[model samples]
Every structure is written in C-alpha cells, then in structure tokens.
Target: MTQDDMPRTVRTLLRELDRASLATILPAEPAGWPYASLVLVAVDHDLSPILLLSDMAEHTKAIKADGRVSLLFDGTGGLDQPLTGPRATVLGRAERIADDRLKARFLARHPDAALYAGFKDFAFYRLTVDRAHLVGGFGKIRWIEAAELVPPQAEGLAEAEAAIVEHMNADHADAIQLYATKLIGRAGDGWTMTGIDPEGIDLRRGGEVARLAFDEPLRAAGEARKALVALVGRARALP
Candidate 1:
C-alpha cells in the first residue's frame, strides 16, 4: 500500500475488525493508570467507533469520569512479525449516546450481543475521533487528522445503507456469494452484506468477515448501486 492508501487501510481495519483493545484512564485511588479491555466495536458511516458497554463495566465508569480514551485495532493476526503488520490507535472522547441507529449498527456487527443489549445497564457510546496514529509498516507511519481520515458524509448513504444491505441479502444472495468467492477469492457460501459505506461493503459468512473496497470512493446511494453492479461484473469476468 502506498502512502495515499493509508486512510483506506485505516478505515478497512476499523470496519473489518470485530473487536479491539479499549484503553481508558483508571478512575480509582491509584488513578491515572491505563486500563485496557477487550471490546466489540462497530463504525458509523463517518468511521467513528461505536461501542456497547454496561454501566457496571470499569471502562464505562472511567468514561463517565473522563471521556478520553484510545482504541487499538490490531491487524497483525497470523503475521510472523507482528510489528510488520498494520495497526491503528484512535484517540477520542467516548460519550454515551441514545441514537437507535448506532445501537442497531453495533448489534448488526455483533448479533450475539443482542441478547443483553436491552438490559437497563447497557448503553451505546460513540467515540468522537480527535485523530489517529497509523503504522502501516516500518517506514509507513503517520498521524492522520480526523478530517483527513474520514470522508465527508455522503448524502443519504447512511440512511440508505440498511435497506440496500437488506435488498442484497434478501434478493441477490448469489451475487453476494460471488463477491466473496469469485471476486475476493474466498471459498464460502452464505456470505451476506452487513453494511455498506462510501468506502466499501462489509460481508459476513458465519464468524468470518470480509471487506471489499471500491476502486474509488462513492458519494451517494445511486453511485453505490453502480459500483456494486460493476464489481460483480468484474468478478464474473475473472477466469
């Protein structure tokens, strides 16, 4: 990946990963220590990380006291030299939110969590990104401002995403499978699109997930439709 590809790589890591290490400041007596915990994550259309936490959780308590937090999305799994792989550290403030859309997005990415999502103590939080530090590889490190990393909101795309995902999963199952196998070269069945954004489409088949990025970023629902059609065509032509 070139330097120009760093933003895309960062978004891919954030979107594709199911879990991340969430670091929050300790609120106790011997305070100021960093507390890291495993957390499931999902991203909004603007790439903001969304999380679901119980009020009793340590991280949630810390956020109530001080919203500042960091999330590490490690993309180095299976690498013989872990440091040679790409990883990102997102610095942000986590504030509890009541948006139903965000909550649904988080649950869509982590369907198993739906069981407890309705409990009174569980609430959703969105990290307002300040910036991100990315290590693409040895000589490919950089600090990316939030503006540089996240694209401007694509008009109507966020609202249209769920319907688009439903249409593909319900009506175009074969094309979805072709995307996983023929396009991205993964051997699979039952691959369904969980989300779509200006950057790419997110696919899931059981526990495994995949990210299929577009050749170029799109700006609206119509453009996304064109891109998806074009992608399957390319996949079909590949021998």
Candidate 2:
C-alpha cells in the first residue's frame, strides 16, 4: 500500500509484526506434508527470518533439500470485528546459518530457547523473503516489500534508547506533565515518554499521545548520548 493510503494503526501494527517472532510451516516426517510444525522465527533488521531448529525436526531436513519455506504470524487486533483479525504470510528461500554472530542475535531475542540452543542436533537457518502479504483487517490488505517493512539501525542505539527510558521514567515525570497540559493542549493529569527510535520518541499523555522526531539524525555514540540528554532537558523545561 502507498504510504498515504495506509492507516497509521496499520503501519504501527506492521512494524510490531516485523519485530515479533514468526512461525514457519514445516513438513511432517514419514508422512504427507499435511502436518506442519510451528517453529519460532527471528527476523533480522532486514526482515529476513531466522530459524533455530533441531535435526530431529522433519521440517529442518525438508528445508535443507527444498530450501523453500512459508511463515505466518498474527497481525494487529480488530476494533469492530473480532473474527476479522489481522495476519501476515511471508514466502522466502531458506539457507542454513553457521555464522556465530547471527546466531547470537537470534538467541538474544529468544533467550528462553537456551534449553535447546546448544544441542549438537540443533541448527539455525535464515530465510530471504521473496514476498509478503499483510492483512490489516478483513478489507484492508496490502503487499509489502521486505526492505520497506524492515527496521533501521542507528549507532549506539541500544544505550541511547535505554537511557531515554530511564531519564523520562525517573526525573522528568512532570515534564510529561507539560506534554499533557500544554503541548497536547489538554489538562495535566498523566503523561510519559515510553520509547525512542531513530525517527523520534513516543509519548504517552493520560489517554492521549504524540510522536516527537528529531530534526537531524543522531549518528555516533557521542551524538546519540548528547541527543538523549537534550531530549530529557527539553522535556524537563516544559511548563
């Protein structure tokens, strides 16, 4: 869908789905491909799927031979209709992964899988997507490019992100107060900044909200640190 034609909630849901764990449909062993096992998948910053599997999984062996796969995941929830929930499906080519770095990222996001992470029988695979179908709702469907749906990487982003959350949740609890009272042009009751990204910071004010973006990119580690400090200061200075 064109950026203008896409709804804001739909866009947000797409991003969230990109970050969520995916389930790959693996063929069952010793039988018809009718049975599919659900496997947890990690998506790289580029929106490629990462799979950790056991040698015992019939699907893993099937992937080694065919190198083709499909993934499915739940999308955003519906407001008007319960049955019309959002969902997504991705078609891709799979490859076995032996890289330690990629494996680390996959494991980090799914630490709970450590129980089987180290078994010699387990392996990791990466999926290069060919196309994706995103269903925002019953009538809202769109095709998405893997690149357009991927997340961005900013240097020192993790540290900057954590610091922003800490400062906002700690010192400037009242500046959030001003966001609710003045910037939003509403009464002061409850407000806070919950998350930050390369684009901007997400603010929660009472039941209302806003997204504040930076005029320029925060490139280096030093720059990100300075930008976050300035952001906290700006919030604190608000009336």
RMSD of each candidate relative to the true structure: 1.4, 7.2
The CA lDDT at 76 in model 1 is 95
TM-score of each: 0.95, 0.58
lDDT of 1 by residue, 138-217 (tens): 89899888887876456888888888988999999988998999888888678888888888888888788788888988
| Cα error of candidate 2 at position 173, Å | 16
TM-score of 2: 0.58
Candidate 2 per-residue C-alpha lDDT over 1-239 given as tens digits, one digit per residue, 9 for 90 to 100: 44444433333443343233333444544433533567765545345667888887777777766777767666544456654766677767888889775575465445567788889999888888776777756676777765555444667664455566667668867765654455445555656665555544555543344555555655544565566556657656776
| Most accurate candidate by TM-score | 1
Best by lDDT: 1
TM-score of 1: 0.95
